[model samples]
Target chain A: MSADRPLEKLRVLVADDSPAMRGIVRAVLSGFGCDRVFEAENGLQALAVTESGGIDLVICDWKMAPCDGIELVRALRDPARSRDPFLPVIMLTAYSETARVREARDAGATEFLAKPFTAETLYQRIAAVINRPRPFVRADGFNGPDRRRLERDHSGAERRQARQS
Target chain B: MSQAKPYEIINPPNKLKAKTGSIPAVNPEAIKRAEEALEQVKSEFRNWLAEEVRKLERAHADIHANGLGGKHGEALFVVAHDLRGLGSTYEFPIVTRLAKSMCKLIETAEKRAAAPRALVDAHVGAIRAALIQNIRSDTDMVGRELVEELERQVIARVGAEG
Candidate 1:
């Protein structure tokens, strides 16, 4: 609960079909000092909000109708359609399987939070995106935040060469 | 890099604005107020859960009467999934665990027509019992044992079919 936490100024959008889930997320964001929290019932609505601009972070559910979290992330990362392709998107889902996590990551989500998450866990994620923002990657196959979770000291030349090859 | 099109303009405009360079400080009073609101929401958990249980019960009946693979099965999965995610947040860890197990049971069932009715019933029953007995903790020995038994049954049934 640091007074200078980065979450205080963030305008977060929480997208979920369940009203209860949306309320809980808004409450958690409020605890983090986020005064401007918006809600979307599905990915379609979430996309509209994202397109309208000014959304710093998105916390989206996986199993929404008309559009799911993966579809939303893909749309946001698409250079032709995205308003802010670099916007941090966090996928909040109950499906903790490897396949689902991979799908979310490949679709350009900045982070993945499993459902039944604690308040502390949520805080840590928001902090991660704020304090330690990742450089966005725009390679032939990938167009989102860097997917690497591990930190290493590879040389800049080596990294660029690796990406090119 | 290509510039993306601006979003469609909505009336009254969205209230969310871009962040300034300096992060705002956390207000202790705001945190306290949010916590109070959360507590108020939790206080109404029993009624909400009861309503979910009724929906689940109806879904179960629909499945039994008309068989699975229809809207009833889908409804059952949706409700169970919601319970799985919300139970722990609302201080009902046992419900979360049970509902998670139930979700898996439904997910792995080979065919809708072949769903294990007894196993589904056990899970639904355990959820109701957990709420009635106020079994909120996953560490509760009785609750743990019940969950394990239900999981074992589901695995065995699915295994047998496979």
Candidate 2:
């Protein structure tokens, strides 16, 4: 076997309406040593899981009702909430079109994997997203109180500017 | 093309049977809809994980520096609760697995005279990696137009009378 990937035992969310598709994804992920797998039938359920918390990776179908992948990405990237910072999104779908690919990017997807994907493709994409960590700062501010104060002051100034406008 | 016959009939599969069918080509629209819904879940999950990681880190900091009251522990608790729910809903065993681990870590730490910050930090790192992988999975999946069409239909039907 190859050098064991550090991501072994990683948690993954598999959201698809089809039990077969979900099973396939789970099996594929487990083949790479992903022992923890999650499944959701719809976007709303997926959102609940996401919001509920602790997901390491999400492998979602491109199509679902009420909320689709694109809309989900848009919601997650909402500037107002800073919903998920640097969350990598890998879209799984059967729609093979250049325009659609472009749109997925616009929808805030970190990576795109077309349907009928091989195990290699799945592992590779998962590897890429998992390897890169998002940049984050403690709510108290990384630098010190001075830095926190500075940020607060900046926000205050912005608020005043908005009022003036 | 064969001519229509009296014996031939179009028995469209019922909703449950249609959903149960393994072959995706039978209903492109349904597949697309499923894909889009899954996508949305994946995206939201990514963000949620990111935020949880940050919160976990903050909790660690609070324990190390000022100790667990005020905003840090509260945030950690909130994120942990969310993870527990998400894990069960999405069918991701690891999310719940880690969430339970972290939740216990926090709850136990709170009861202790001096919390174990180091162990908590290690768990936080593990959870963070898991969250990142989740996001990557979301982006890697494909099939866009079908999902888009589903989105369009949902929009068109949201206000329609039954």
Top-TM-score structure, candidate number: 1
- Report per-prediction Cα RMSD to one decimal: 6.8, 23.9
Write the residue-wise lDDT of candidate 2 on A1-165 in tens digits: 122323344567777654555765765565554567888876777777777666666777766656777776666555443344334567876544566676776665666787655555665666555443222222211210111211334543221111111
* Candidate 1 pairs with clashing backbones: none
Model 1: CA > 4 A from native:
A1-6, A150-165, B1-37, B108-114, B157-162
**lDDT against true structure, model 1:** 0.75
Query: For residues A5-119, could you state the per-residue lDDT of candidate 1 as single tens digits?
Result: 3356677899998888888888777666677899999999999998898788899998888898888998888889888777788899887777778888888898889989866
Q: Pick the candidate with the highest lDDT.
A: 1
Q: Highest DockQ: which candidate? A: 1
Model 1 CAPRI rating? incorrect
Give DockQ for candidates 1 onward, in order. Answer: 0.22, 0.01
Instruction: Give one digit per residue, the lDDT tens place, for model 2 in B1-162.
Output: 443222211222222112222222233333343344445445454455455457666666666686666656655654554454345334444555455455544543343224355545655565566566652221223212322333343334332210
lDDT values for all models: 0.75, 0.51
| Candidate 1 lDDT, B88-108, residue by residue in tens | 877888888888788877864
Error of 2 at A115 (Å): 0.5
